[model samples]
Target: MNLFRHAAFEISVASPDGLPFSPAPEVAFAGRSNAGKSSAINTLAGHTRLAYVSKTPGRTQLINLFRLKNGAALVDLPGYGYAEVPAAVRRQWQGLLEHYLTRRENLVGLVLIMDARRPFTDLDRKMVAWFGTTGKPIHCLLTKADKLTNQEQIKVLRDAKAEAASLVGNITLQLFSSLKKKGIEEVEKIVGGWLNPEIRGEAS
Candidate 1:
C-alpha cells in the first residue's frame, strides 16, 4: 500500500442482528481510549478525517469498517477502558466488540494500538488475551513514538515485546507516530502484506 492514496469512510451498524457481513478481508484496529487509534488510521489512510476524531475518550461506540481499494476492510473498534459513557451504552459496545472480534469471519489480524509512554497496562494485557483466543495475528503498535526520546522508544518496544510474548505467541511490535508521520511507511507495508493472500505469520 502507498499509505498516501487509500480511500476510507465511516461504517455504522444500523441493526445489531449480527455484524454486517462483508466478503472483504478485515484487519481491526483496537486499543484503549486516548491510545490514538483514530489518528493512526487517518495517518495510514492518508486522510485527516477518514475515521471519526472525537475529543471525548471512548466516543467511538461502533465497529467502524473502511473499505480499501484491494477489497480489504480496515475495522476501527471502540476504545475500551475508563469511558464516561452510560452503563447500558457501554455494555452495548462491549458486546459488539466481543462479537466482532471473536466471530467476524473476514478478520485477518488485529492492530493493537498502545500509548508508547504507557504500553503495558492492564487493558493491553486483556486485549492480548482476547487476540490469543481468536488465533489471529496481533500487531502491537506503539503509538506516540515521536513524543519519547529514541532511548525511551527503544526501551518501550523491548518491554512491550516481552509482555506480548507472555500473553500472545505470534505478535509484532512497531514504533509509530501519527503526528510526526513516523513509521507510516513501515505500517503501510505491513498492512498491505496482511491484506495480501500469501504472507503468513504476523503482519509485521
Candidate 2:
C-alpha cells in the first residue's frame, strides 16, 4: 500500500515534551533552512499543501508530525543554519533536536535533505554525526537537483555517498528535485517500507 498517500498532519511540537508517545516508528525529515525539506515532504505525499513551503528561511520552528493511516509517522524537524533567528532560540532548537534524536524510542530513521548545489554544510555534518551515534538509518535527499547539470548532479551524488561512507551509521543518499518531481517514487517506496506493517521490519 502507498503509506505516504495515507499521510495526514498530526501535530506541531515546539518543545521536546510535546512529542506524543506513539508506538509507530517515525521517519524524521531534516535539513538546513530553505533546503526544500517541506517541499520534499509535500512531493512525497503527492499532495500540494501537505507541508507548508516557506520562502523565508528558519520559518519552520516546530517539529511537525504527519501520521499515516497505518500508524507510522513522518516528522518534520525545524531547519537549522539560518542566523536571522535569535541565538538563544537556535540553542534551544539544538537542545530540542538532541533530546528528540536520542530519546525518541519510536524514531526509526532520518531523512536528511540538502541542496544539490551545496551538499553537506557544517550544520549538516553535525546533524549526521548526532544521529549517526544511534546507529539508525539516515538517507539524505539532495534537493534542488533540477538546478544542476546532469554531470554536476552525479558528482554531488558520488561525493555525498563517499562522505556517508565515513559516517557512524548507515547513511545513504540520492539526487532529488521536488520541483521536477524526480526520484519521488523511489523515495516513496523506501519510506513506505518504514510505514508498512508487513515490510517495515525488513527496512532496517
Candidate 3:
C-alpha cells in the first residue's frame, strides 16, 4: 500500500500560537513559490488537490497540515521568494517558518522541494541552514525533472548532490517530476522511515 495515499487535510495555521499539538511525527515540505512544491505534495498523496496548485506564486499563505492514516502528519509550509508578495507578509511567513522548523518537537524531518533546473537558490540554502541547526534529516526533491532532458537530469542530480554535500546535517537529493509521477516511492520510503523509525530502525 502507498503510505501517503491516505493523507487528508487537517488544518491551516496562520500564526505560531495556532499550531496544533500532536504526538505523531511530522514531515515538512518547503520550497520557493511556483517551484512545484504543492504539485509534488499532491502527487505524493495520490490526490489531485491534496495541496492546492496555484498559477500564482505565494498563494499558500498559511502553514497547512495534512494527517496521514497512521497518525503521522505532513506540513505544507507557505512558499517563499515571491517578490510580488508584500514585504510584511513575507516577513511573517519567514517568522512562522523559523519558529516551526526550530521549535516543533514532533517534526521528524523536512522534504525540501526545488525546481530541477534551479536547485539551491540563496533562499533554499538559507532554509537548509536553518533546518540543519536542528540536526534532522532533509530529503530534497528536484521537481519538474520532466522539463529537463535525460542528460540534463543526470547532470543536475550530480551537481545537486555535490552542492548538498557542503550543506550542514544529513541531506539527501533526488530528481522528482509531478507530471511524470516520478520519485514518489523514494520520498515515501524516506518520510515513512522518519515517521516510523521502528519499522526501518532509523532515518537515513
Candidate 4:
C-alpha cells in the first residue's frame, strides 16, 4: 500500500511550543529551500498540492504536519539555506529544526530530500552531522533524478551511497524523482517500516 496516500494537513506550527501532541510516530521531511522538499511530499502522498509548492524559496517558514490514515504523521519542516531570508528568520528556523529533531520523542526517523544533481551541500552536511547525534535513522532521497541522465543517475546514487557511509547514524540513500513518480514504492516501503515497526518486525 501507498502509506502516504492518505496524508492530510493537520497543523502548521511556527514555534516549538505550538507543536501538537501526536500519539503516532512522525517522520520528518527536511532539506534546503528549492530542493523539491514539498514536491516530494506531494508526490509521495499522491496529491498534487498536499504540500504547497512555491516558486519562491523559504516560503514554508512553519513546521507543517500531515496525519496519515494509520495515524502516523509526516512533518514538513521549514526549508533552510535560503539567501533571501533574513538572518533572524534563518536563525529561528535553525532553532526550530534543532529542537524538533533532537527533542521530539515520537519522531521515528527523518527523510532528507536533496537534488539529484547536487546530493549534499555544506548545509546538508551540517544537518546530517547534527541530526546524526540523535542516533536515529535517516533516509536521504535524491530527488529530481529525472533531470539526470541514466549514467549520471547511477553515478550519483553510487557516490551518494559512498558519501553516506561516512555520515553518522543509520543512513540510507536512494534516487527519487517527483516529476516521474519514480522511487515511490521504495520510499513507501522504507518509511512505512519506520512508521509501523510491527509490520517490519513481522516480516523479518
Candidate 5:
C-alpha cells in the first residue's frame, strides 16, 4: 500500500497536554517492554526507523503520536512491564495510560502487541479487560512469529483467539513478525478501517 508514501510523524505527548485533540480517529499500539511494539509500527508504516523511539528497551516513556498521510493518528504508547523503571515512574505511566485509554474521545481502537512465543500473561489479560471496558476495538498482534515453528504458531494463534474471544467481542488477532515484515499489511488494513469505519465494516 506504500503506507510510507502517506505517513508522517505528527507529535509526541509527554504529558496529557500533548495528547492529540483534533478529533481524528486514532489507533493505539501498546505492549510490554521488549515486546516488539515499536518494530511493528515501523513495519506497518513501511519505514524502518519511523517508529524507533529507542533501540534500548524501556526508554519510550511517553505517548508518541504519528500522523499518517490520510490524517489518521498512530499512537505509540510507552511499554509497560519494564522492571528496571522505578515503581513511582511505572505508576505514573499506568495513570497516564489509564487516562488516555478511558478518556480519549477520538480513540478508535487498540493494537495490542504481544510476543508470539510467550502468549498471554496476567498483565495482558488485565489489559484486555481494561481496554474492553472502554469499548474500543482491539486487534491483538502476536509479534515475533518467526521464532515459532509452524505447528506451534498455529496452536498459539488459536489459543490466543480463544482467550481473547472469552474476554471481548469485536476483536481481531494476527500473526506478526517485524523482522520479516510479516502481517504489516494486515495491521495497516485494520487500522485503516478504524479511521474509516464506513469502509472497514461493522462486523469481523
Candidate 6:
C-alpha cells in the first residue's frame, strides 16, 4: 500500500493549547475557503472521507490532525476568508493558526492548496506572508485544474510559480485535480519526502 493510504483522522483542536505534542514530523494543509484542501487530502489517502468535505465555505473551523502508520502526521487547518462566519470566531482562528504555524516545533512543511482558476487572493497573499516567517518548505497544489482548459491551466501554473518565488523563499508548485486524481503521485512524493528523514533534506 502507498504510505498515506491508511491516513486516518486523529484529533481536532480549536485552540493551540489543546494541540497534541507528537515527536513525529508534521506537514499541514492550509488554504482559503472552498480551495479543495480537504478533497486533496482525501484523494491522496485513497479514501472518500479522510477529511470532511463541506459545501459551506467556513464550516471547518478547527485544526484537524491525521496520523499515518509511520508516526508522521498531516494537519488540516481551518480555511481562511469566510466572511459569513462570526468576526469573533474568525479572530479566534487567526490567533490559533498563527500560534500553531509560528511556534509548532514538529512542523516540517506546509501544503498550500489553491484553486487553479483563482490561485491567490488578498487573504492568500497574507497567508504566504505569514507562513514565510516560519522558514519551512511550502508546497502549493493548484487544485481544480481539470476545470480549466490545458492552456489556461498552464498559464495559471506559470503565473503562480512566478509570484511564489517573490512571496515564499522555499516553495514548490504543481497542478492538481482531486476529482480526476491528477498530480496525486507528485503530491504524495513531496509530502512523503517531508516525513522521511533520509529524504527530508531533498524536500527542504
List, residue by residue over 1-204, the lDDT tens digit for candidate 6: 376789888899988678788888988889989999999989999999889999999888889999988888888999988899899988988877788888888899889989998987888887778888778878999999999999999899999999897885578999999999999889888777777797766645
lDDT of 6 at 17: 70
Task: Give per-residue CA lDDT, model 5, range 168-198, as digits (tens).
Answer: 5468899999888888778777776677757
Alpha-carbon deviation at 135 in model 2, angstroms: 1.1
In model 3, what lDDT does residue 145 have?
100
Error of 2 at 151 (Å): 0.9
Report model 3's TM-score to 2 decimal places.
Answer: 0.96
lDDT by residue (67-86, candidate 4, tens digit) is 99988899999999999899
Q: For model 3, what is the alpha-carbon lDDT of residue 34? A: 98
Model 4 misplaced regions, further than 4 Å: 199-204
Off by over 4 Å in 5: 2-5, 53-55, 197-204
Q: How many steric overlaps does candidate 5 have? A: 1
Task: Work out the TM-score per prediction.
Answer: 0.90, 0.94, 0.96, 0.95, 0.91, 0.95
Candidate 3 per-residue lDDT, tens place, 113-133, comes to 999999999999999999998
Candidate 2: stretches off by over 4 Å = 196-204
Report the alpha-carbon TM-score of model 6 versus the true structure. 0.95
Worst 10 residues of 3 by lDDT: 195-204
> Which predicted model would earn the best lDDT?
3
lDDT, candidates in the order shown: 0.79, 0.87, 0.92, 0.91, 0.81, 0.87
Residue pairs with backbone atoms closer than 3 Å in model 2 (clashes): none
lDDT of 1 at 53: 84
lDDT score of model 2? 0.87
Note the residue pairs that clash in candidate 3: none
Quote the lDDT for 55 in model 6: 95
Candidate maximizing TM-score: 3
